[model samples]
Target: MKIRVLGSGHSGGTPMIGEGWGNADPKNPKNYRTRPSIVVENDKTRILVDTSPDLRVQLLAANIEHIDAVLYTHGHADHLNGIDDLRSVNRAMNEWIPAYTDAKTWSDIVNRFNYVLEPLKNDTNVFYKPCLKRNDITVGQQFEIGDFCIGVMDQDHGFMRTLGYRINQFAYSTDVVELPEESFKTLNGIDTWMVGALWEEPHITHAHVDKVINWAERVEPNRLILTHLSHRIDYETVSKRLPEFAELAYDGMILEL
Candidate 1:
């Protein structure tokens, strides 16, 4: 299996519009992040984790043309806003994509893009808008998408709840601050864990550097890749602080398992 880091930055992404790279170096391309998203794929299937606001550019940069499924972590704008860009994929693939998410997240998505959730018209060739088949999932549920057998667990995002996904030995937990006991049990013994860590300091809604390290110590994954970074984190400086088993995720980084 291969996991591609489509975008690794926090909600605002690195080098915010009004505020430039906070602690990040301008010379390091690794600090030039977009939004949070990833693509998990094996030889037969490609599954997108989230449609980040930078999905278009991210997909282009990664040279990804088609995806079999989309799994949403939550309804945050950074994670869900770029959903409209999936229309281009719909047009290219000539089929409706299957998107999986919790009921509340689906509700938020429906409120925003109701049209995309509507049934496809009889004329399938008309790909003017995104056509998606909604598959409402629940915590602790297990499902299969192509070559993946996925397990879902509940995550606490402080203000709201999100879903973490486990597929084979690789698990993804983004936009989360607290992993419930059940979620940690689900993540136990994973080989690679790509989790969210906004910065070095403690955060109300997202996990920080120390917090993630603590979690990693418990789960003890062979490789721990931190994602959903903020401008407050400088690549070179933060890299030195992490243990040898852990590393910061950069845009376009690919991990083969």
Candidate 2:
């Protein structure tokens, strides 16, 4: 399987409009993050995780021509707000795309993007709008997209809950502050893990370096990559602090398993 980190920055992204680069160095390409998103693809399928607000540029830069499905971690603006960009993909493939999320998240999405949620019709014009089929997923239940089997686990994201997905030997957990006991069990044996870490300090709604490292210690994946990073976390500084098998993720980073 091949995993591509389309964007690794937190909600506002690095060099947030008007805020500049914060602690991140302006010269480092790794620090030029877009927003949090990733693409998982193998020979048979291509699945997107979260449509970052920077979706248009990210997809164009990645030269992604097709998407088999989209798995939403939550309905947060950072993750689901760029959903309308899927219309480009819809036009590319000339078909409706399936997006999976939990019931609450799906409900919010349907309510927010009522036009996109409309049922497809024989005379529907996909070019004029995105055609996405919302599939409500149950936590811990396994589902399929092409040849891969995916499982979702509940994650703690402040007052709201999000999802972490496990696909084969790799798992992705973003926008999470804590992993429930059941979530740990679900991620126990992954070979590669893409986990969310907001910064070096503790955060209320996002994982910090210390917390995620502790989880990595217990999960013991072959490689641990920290994503959903904030501008406060400098690439060089964080890279120096990470374990030999772990590192901070950057936009456009790709891992093959």
Candidate 3:
């Protein structure tokens, strides 16, 4: 299996429009982060996680031509705003994509982008709209997308909730501050963990660096990649401080696990 970090930055991304690269170097490509998103794929299928506001550029950068499924972590704007871009993929493939998310997230997504989930029109000539088959799942439920076994767990994201996905020994969780005791069981035995860490300081909605470090220590994953990072954390500086098992993720970083 291959897990690719399509975009590793937080909602606003690095080098914010109004506030340029705070502590990061603008010349560094790593500092040019986009919104958070990833692609998990194997020989048989390609599953996209989160659409991200920068989904089009990210996909173009990664040269991704096809996607079989989409798994949403939450309904936040940064994560779902690029949803309309999927219409081009639908048109190219000539097939409606299947998107999986928990009931609440699914409801929120459909409520906002109802056209994407709506049934396709009888006419085949019109191909400018997205037609996705929505699958509402429950947290902690196990499901299959092609040949992979997926385990879902609920995450604590302050005002809103999110879902974490685990596939085999690789787990991806972001936009999270706390992982409930019950959810720990779902993360057990994961060799690789891609989690969120905003900065060194505490954050209400996202995990702080210390909190993420503690989680990694407890989970004891062989490899840990931090995502959803903000400009407050410089790529090279943070990379130097991270433990051997953990490091910061950059856009287009591919891990063949």
Candidate 4:
């Protein structure tokens, strides 16, 4: 399996508009970051996790033409607001894309994008169709999405409750502030892990460096990558701080398992 780091910037994105804090050194080329999103692909499927407001630009940057499904972790705007970008692909594919999310997330998406469920009208009604079929998921359940076997982990971010997904040998947990002991128990034996490490300091709705490191101590995957980065974690600094087996993910980074 191949995992692509579609984006790694925080909520507002790195070099956030009107805020001059991304790559300060114009001469240094490694400080750029985009909104947080990841793409996982195997021979038979291509699944996207969390479509941020930057989805269009991110997809274009990756040169991807189509997607097999969308898996949502939570309902935050930065994680889900770019949902409308699916329209183009849907028009071409001519099928409702499968969407896997929790019940609350499904409700929120339907409520936020009512046009998706509102019936089509006759004559000259100006309307749009959202190409999504939301399927509610449960914690601790095992399932499959195309060729990948999936395991769900219920997590809490203080701000909201979300799920972490373990597919094949790789497990992904983003937008997580704090994970309960049980969640970590479920993720104990993954070969590779892609998780969030917001910044160096504690945050109300995201994990700080110290927190994730402590959690990492528990799961102890063979390889752990820290993503969902923020302006505070410059590449050079965070890279030096991480363990040799772990890495700091940047936009365009890809991992093969």
- In terms of TM-score, the best-performing candidate is 1
Ranking by TM-score: 1, 3, 2, 4
Best by lDDT: 1
Which is the winner by lDDT between candidate 2 and candidate 3?
2
* Residue-level lDDT tens digits of model 3 in 157-255: 999889999987899999998899867899999989999998889999999887898999999999999999898888888889888999889998899
Q: What C-alpha lDDT does candidate 1 achieve relative to the native structure?
A: 0.94
lDDT of each: 0.94, 0.92, 0.90, 0.82
TM-score of each: 0.98, 0.97, 0.98, 0.92
* Better by lDDT, candidate 4 or 1: 1
lDDT of 4 by residue, 60-149 (tens): 888876889888888888888988887766766666678898888888887797665554567423325656776778888888999999
Pull out the clashing pairs in model 3.
Answer: none
Selected candidate, larger lDDT, 2 vs 4? 2
Q: For model 2, what is the error of residue 213's alpha carbon versus the real structure, in angstroms, after optimal superposition? A: 0.6
Pick by lDDT: 3 or 4, better one: 3
How many clashes (backbone atoms < 3 Å, residues ≥3 apart in a chain or on different chains) does model 3 have? Answer: 0
Q: Which parts of model 1 have CA positions greater than 4 angstroms off?
A: 121-124
Per-residue lDDT over 107-224 for candidate 1, one digit per residue giving the tens place of the 0 to 100 score = 9998999999876678567888898899999999999998788999899999999999999899999988999999999997799999999999998999998899999999999999
